[model samples]
Target: MAAEQQAPSILGFPHRPEWGAAAHRRAVAGYLRRCRDHARIGARQAARCIGTSESTLSRLETGLAPLKPVEVERLLDVYGVRDPAERQRITLLVAEATQPESWHPYAHAAPNSLRPLLAMEPAARRIISYEPQLVPGWLQTEEYAQIVIRATHPTLPAKEIDERVRLRRARIDMLRRRVDPPVLLAVMDSEVFRRQVGTPGVMYRQITYLLTLLEDLRYQLRLHIAPLSVGAAGAIGHPIVHLRFFAPEYLPDMVYLEQYEGAVYREKPSESERYLAVLNHLCGVATPADQTASLLRQALDTWR
Candidate 1:
């Protein structure tokens, strides 16, 4: 008699409808790594089984290389993934990973480093952001974003500038209108209010917009102002965003550190924890969320 068939093991890849290509790639990479670990196979052995170099497999696992559906199937076989359901989910992830994201059109305007952050933003369950010099991008008003972009890229063509602004607006609308939007905890230095971006009217309007959003209960936004008196909360003079996803069982938290020219993505728990620690420190030093509205009103008075 034939041996009895075993029930398929469920490998939980992100099944969300809102997941973009980047998210799918992330899921695929994570799933592959986990599957290999479960099978107790070393990278060299697995790569040999799949007829690929260990370095090539390393790139696939790190999401630096595209994962084709055929390659996924071969890797699954090598990793002893016998469950059909698991295989199907992986196939779907591979398909999704190859698809274009909403920002694909404006890819020319966005730096390659920034693309991953844009892709991951929609999938985040909660976002903790600390901006030392400017308002967080997710919270910036259209006018404010335009002025900041123009100032940063003085030589950028007018048309490209417009495209970048539109991309920013689109991102804001998408996040704002989500059925289950990510909770946003944003900490900005008090110096951000003092550092003028555009005209006085622009600053006033931006502050008013921020106040309105702070009062609105629908957005799930918590705004904090790190007072000048705090005097260096140990967050370096850059922006840090730590994104937490809904599926902690399979997905790991990510930290995005934005530099002057590019950005870095921290996915390992050890690396992400350090940034999370810095964010926690900033949160502790910043004024409480309840007092944020009053601080904004005071800043508004300065513009007035």
Candidate 2:
């Protein structure tokens, strides 16, 4: 039962964001902390209650160790988390935790612990993202995605690129599966389209895809274009993603900073609010989502 999950996807390869399982792990870890803290219990005391060593409990709290379903139940009992609803909520995460992570296959490419992003993506009520370098992954067409991957990952073999592109496409498809798909507010710079990725044709097709998405009000996509005129006011050097959760207890609001080495997640209210502030500033200075289609069209025409 300790085996890591490798849930197969209809996309054929492991493309499902391994976030749900990761989310479950995070939820379990968080629930235990709250229970322990509220009861004014120490790790050693809690460990004694649950029949585990102090170090083991510490590892669990820090997310350094995986918890078995039995362990979760035991910990919950010991922590005085007797509320049935709370128990059930935690139990649901336990089942979710059992599902396999899809990123295990591509661990070679994305070595970072990005499972949190995947976990939160499906459950988020809204996603506010700012992309200054290129198009956001979710909005990219296959051709555009290939170009980005090839340029950034020059050393990657063709097979791996194909594998990732397929997985990414599957991730985009995933948005349709959620009962209430999160509202995606994506702000990107005009330079992303102005720059040549694969060829003029590739850029045109990408712009076309964005145009289609922009017109589809039903898709919950609000796309804003930050022109060169806006300068550094609307963007920083890296991509910023803010995830807002519906169930604050199980999942917390987060700010994700994409770095070349890996990803950084900020959860503290104070730290995350700073990123949110930047996003708000960008929105104020940039073109509205409703007006973005025309700018996209102009870029597409220039590419032609």
The model with the greatest lDDT is 1
lDDT scores of the candidates, listed in order: 0.81, 0.74
Candidate 2 C-alpha lDDT tens digits along 1-304: 4333321111111112334566556667776776677667788888887788999988787555777888888877766666666676667666776776655555554445465676567656788889998999888899888878888789989988886676566556545655656778899988888778888888888899888767764477888888889976954999999988655555668888888867898998888888889998898788987788778878878888
The segments of candidate 1 whose C-alpha lies over 4 angstroms from its true place after superposition are 1-10, 48-51, 217-219
Question: Could you tell me every candidate's TM-score relative to the true structure?
Answer: 0.89, 0.85
- The deviation in Å at residue 154 for candidate 1 is 1.0
Q: Count the clashes in each prediction.
A: 0, 3
Clash pairs detected, candidate 1: none
On a 0 to 1 TM-score scale, where does candidate 2 land against the true structure? Answer: 0.85
Residues 1-304 of candidate 1 have per-residue lDDT tens digits of 2322332243655566575677778778877887787777899998887678999989888777788888888878877787777878877778888888757879877778888888888778888999989988877788999999999889999889888887876766545654777788899999899999899998999999898777774467898899878876734788999988866655688999999889989989999888888898889988999999988999999999
The alpha-carbon deviation from the true structure for residue 243 of candidate 2, after best TM-score superposition, in angstroms, is 0.7
- Position 255, candidate 2: lDDT: 87
Best by TM-score: 1
